[model samples]
Target: MTNRTFDEMQPGDRAELRRLITADDLFVFAAASGNSNPMHLTDTDVDGNGTAERIAPGMFMASLISAVLGTQLPGPGTLYRRQTLDFHTRAHAGEEVIVRAEVVSKAEGMVRLRTEVTHADGRQILTGEAEVIAPVEKFDREDVEVPGLVVQRHRHFEALLERARPLPALPTAVVCPNEAKSLGGALLAARESVISPILIGEAEAIRRAADEIGADLGGIEVIDVAGDAAAAELACRLVHDHRAAAVMKGHLHTDDLLKPMLDKAHGLRVGRRFTHVFVMDVPGHPEPLFVTDAAINIAPDLATKMDICQNAIDLALSLGMEPRVGVLSAVETVNPAIQSSIDAALLSKMADRGQIKGGQVEGPLAMDNAVDMGAARTKGLKGSVAGRANILVVPGLDAGNMLAKQLAFISHAEGAGLVLGAKVPVILNSRSDSPMSRLASCAVAAIRHFAGAR
Candidate 1:
């Protein structure tokens, strides 16, 4: 690589680089830049030209000029001052893009370059002009290692929304909409046609919060209620009365929402006990992970864990997956001292007795043995669920909660939560969760709703 100084640069100085625009490239770009307009990346989205091909963003094409200037022409130490761009045509994914830059003039340590980007077919996609301050003196630079980019795919939530798209928007009662994340989630799901939101909370408070967030709630139904508890009661009532198919927690404590549902008289309780599952999409993991008892069951006993395991298995079935339950413990052997290992052994035996259905159950396995085949083989663990478990049944709520949070924050996994074993799926979300999290929960509820009806 050569670094050209202002003294060495001439009128004819030029540089060019070619790169293939791949699907992963487009996906990373869209996610990193937050430019998720479907027309730019979605193949099924209709563009203005009535084409379905994935078109790259105009700025994405123009970025090649900057790359050329920094890495090739005035290579390294080039300071970009200004640039003018014109998009001539849309660049689709898988097309090879060639970027060429020619120095039009150089004066007073500044170089003016004429840049153009064309497809492999020689069709011009973008033309631009850049003014950069050239290095006055060249320095012999050693190769610097650049950090790799970490792209959060959020594909688990995306797939959930896709599954919910075919079904009509389920009418969902959102309790306590005075907060932005919850309200924004409800509105976003409604916009995507995943849920028809029936807002039940303080009307003026909801409107005020909406105004602060610039949410347009026009024509949306709002049922006025005083507090979070009242909102929860009404939301559950709507579900019980067949006025709503699902209930969403909004700006309220988890206990507030669950209290009304556990009433046993007016609640939405089915035959089973209510438990929560965090559907996690972890990068580098082969499949989606079902982490149970994370949100709802705090310190459940053996009987409660049975419900947790069954609920997670039912959820896996709802998502069209073959459930493989791993009874996770600290060690892979039954120890009376470690209650978790004992519970794991019992859970596995219970599955054999038809106490748990529709899932392959394996027990007393460490977390590594459950998910990693190599580790399981090294530990002499052999079973369908031992090495390839999709649903991990933790012994207690604390371990499950920490595992799910670690996957989400440390491993950059996307998590969508649902409380099952009720007549209707209850979407449970954290205040820090994104709108996509809420949408994903709604999608889960929608799938559960429809699947149960069948």
Candidate 2:
């Protein structure tokens, strides 16, 4: 550790830190700063778009200057007063850059420094001047490691918007929004242009709840139904009549809304069995995991599991992923007593025999083997979907629900729930879910609704 005091510092003293740029560095910077510009994110150079090559934000590179000043130059007890910077060129990814700061002048309490950043080739990128109040006393402290921050930039929301940009917002009927979370989510989605919500519930109660949540219901369509059952029926009726493109589960129980969708006469069922999928963006997972049957299909048999697997695969394809299915079990071996392992083996065979299509399937795998290649190798498991499986098809609803909730609560994931295999996608959000989660569900449903139209 280096420490510099005002008494020890002389004019023209300099300190420099050198580092190579990395993609993770750029991503972390973007995440921390909430800069979602495509020019900084994408690899392919947009031709004639008047943007430079895949570049990191100028301020991101300049932050290294602040780091050098506070941590090394005036060293730790320096308070940054002001900074003036000029960026000459875009600092791109994969380029080495050096940050240099030199003490230019020192007043009684204020110290001014000249700062500049240059490429490995000595091309100037940024030059700045920083004035700081240096510590007079020996303000000594032991060096500590800064904890890594999990900057969830909400990249999931951006990706969803890319798919949703061209399509029109879905006319969605939100069933039985008796509380703030449900009603507020729908209103937020509508505000974001993701869903054109037709709020279906008791009008006076809905308005009161909306007031409590500070959501304006003016100019928004609201169907005044007497109770939860009637609201569910009307929501289903709207979808069946093509008046609404989707139905969303609100404050009521999932069964309350789902029952109307299962009706033979007026339900939104096509020829396929309805199931649920939770799209999860876990912290360290390289890709989003499509978790299936988490909210539906309790203890499904082989045939029903097949439908569940196919439904997940279809959703993955809609999102432009050639999904590798991992049929998870307690252990990576078929046993006579454990029915999950048996079903896993059967699903694998079904994929091989062309009974289940549109995904690469491998199964009879424990959680570790399904997700970790090293674990898979250690267990002598060799298959395409063994380690790199992005879609997790759990044994039953209990297992799937637990796994998805663990990823959401324990790992702090961004989750969106949707019902697949229906005539229209059902945006499903729990009463306790965040507004962002609900908005994400609406985006997924809108994308699925438009994709289904094709």
Candidate 3:
């Protein structure tokens, strides 16, 4: 960085900078300025046009002028005296704009400059003038670095919903949707056209739940079943009869829901045991993160862990992701005393032998090395899945559950839970899940269902 002194300033001296507007920039600006008007937000449609314009805030364009004054032209140690702005047109996220400042005059230890911002196509967006006190002494220094910001947005889930929207809604048997949270979540997915829900629960309780959420249950199927177990059984029957393509847990214990599905005589079970996967959209992560056996499979043995890995890999492939499985353990190296490390090493070898298909599998990775390049490099680990693993296969249920929850609560990730390896996808959602989380679960199930159909 270099600055011009007041005495050295001359007419026609100019400086300019170009910036490409991004959706995150709008969010960051909104957060920093406390101006959350929908017009300046990335996900809002103020005109009822159904498309988000993501218009850049006018003040944001004006701020570019300040950037020029502080860093360029009168480069450093510049103090603002007065400024005037005139808006000509609009700028939006994803557009590039050039901000320019030119020296106009100097008097009374103050420098006046003509400032303007224009689109890359030569269309003017903002015209402005700035008056500032130029630095008395020449200033020169290295550029200062500032920390980057990541907006806590669940874009992965959003993309999943978008991909599922084009498919025919999956006919889902929602077992025991007798509470506001559960019923409302199913209905929300219905509204989004992700699922066509067949409500299987007590009619009166379902109606009450609809009332609580102010949701209309008109034209939607409602099967009256007295007990939770009965409703779950009926849902399983629906899947067996091919009336429903997916099973959704609603306001019922997971054990009750899966017990009927596990029946040998009449069940939704395939050969593989049921395994749970949480598809998480963590903020700032470049890709979706998958945690397996989080809600099921306690203390899984070698065979069960193989099923877990294969199920997760299948789910990832269904979602168009190339699975990179990281069997997490206490340490990156195998220790004979550490059962998890041994299991991880065995899983890696099994994957190499084509036992666990459709993924790059590596194991005995601590949590840090599994997802972080720096940690993986520090440990001198070299494998396709060592550092870039998207699917984290924990040693047991306890570890998987804790890791998923930590990402959800502490890392501010939104998760969509699903039970895989069944004949059909099972949408599993928690009572404490947000509406988006619930909807995302249904969306994931719908996508997986359609992908299998194809």
Which model scores highest in lDDT? Answer: 3
Top candidate (TM-score): 3
lDDT for each residue of candidate 2 in 1-454, tens digit (9 for 90 to 100): 5569999898999999997886667788777799967777777666556655568788888899988987888988889899999998767778889999999999888999999999988899999899999977665667757987664545666678667756787899999776888888888888888889898999888998988988778898988999889999998888778899889888898898899889988888887788899998777677778888998799888988899889989888888787899999999999989999999999999999999999988888899999999999999988788889998999889989899889888888878999988788899887667777888888888887777679
Please report how far candidate 1 places residue 93 from its true position, in Å. Answer: 6.0
Give the poorly placed runs of model 3, Cα more than 4 Å off: 42-45, 48-52, 137-143
2 versus 3: better lDDT goes to: 3
TM per candidate comes to 0.74, 0.77, 0.95
Q: Model 3: per-residue lDDT, tens digit, 334-394? A: 9999999999999999999999999999999999999999999999999788789999999
Model 1's alpha-carbon lDDT is: 0.87
Mind sharing the TM-score for model 2?
0.77
- Please give the clash total of every predicted structure, in order: 0, 0, 0
In model 1, the runs with Cα more than 4 Å from the true position are 1-22, 28-40, 44-46, 55-150
- What is the lDDT of every predicted structure here? 0.87, 0.86, 0.93
Model 1 Cα lDDT, one tens digit per residue, 37-155: 78776778474566686788888888878889988888777999999988888888878999999999999889999999998889999898899999876756677668876556766
Clashing pairs in 2: none
